[model samples]
Target: EPEVTQTPSHQVTQMGQEVILRCVPISNHLYFYWYRQILGQKVEFLVSFYNNEISEKSEIFDDQFSVERPDGSNFTLKIRSTKLEDSAMYFCASGRDSNTEAFFGQGTRLTVV
Candidate 1:
């Protein structure tokens, strides 16, 4: 079975530093999304991308956050400046369409100091 893969399963960064979380979603899926879970909190939607453009985004995806599909196979989330509150498990998800069940990656755990 196909699955999403994220690099550097765990990352530790200093506050105010930049971090780039990377993911390779399922190839055949047409829609991709980025979500984050802050510790025990519920999973929160960040942004969604399709056809090489941002389809939608949540308020949490502020100026500090950006998503990009630099190539056909990879999707990435960049946090320009890290904060202690930004520490969380960032998940990459993909689905064939908006109505379908999304497949999620194992997630990248980001820890800010």
Candidate 2:
């Protein structure tokens, strides 16, 4: 069985710092996405990437955030600047295609103080 893996399951940072969350999805998956859940809030979609470019993005993925596939095996999300409101659990997910099942990583809990 294949699954998505995320590093540094927990992270703590200052309000104005920067953070990079990493994830590795199943080898054969073709669609990748980043989603987040703020404490006590609903899960929200951030952005989707495919064919090495952004396919879709939500309002939450503003100028402060960026996604990259630095190589064939890893995907990364970088936040240029962190804010107290940026604290949340970020999940990395991948699917075989647009209509298939998507596997989600355990998530990286980010806390900004």
Query: What TM-score would candidate 1 get against the native?
Result: 0.98
What TM-score goes with each of the models? 0.98, 0.98
- In the predicted model 1, the residue pairs found to clash are none
Candidate 1 lDDT, tens digit per residue, 7-90? 879999999999999999998999999999999999999999999999999999999999998889999999999999999999
- Model 1, position 83: C-alpha lDDT score: 94
Worst 10 residues of 2 by lDDT: 1-10
lDDT of 2 by residue, 7-99 (tens): 889999998899999999899999999999999899999999999999999999999999999999999999989999999999999999999
Which window of 10 residues has the lowest lDDT sum in candidate 1?
Answer: 65-74
Candidate 2 ranges with C-alpha deviation above 4 Å: none
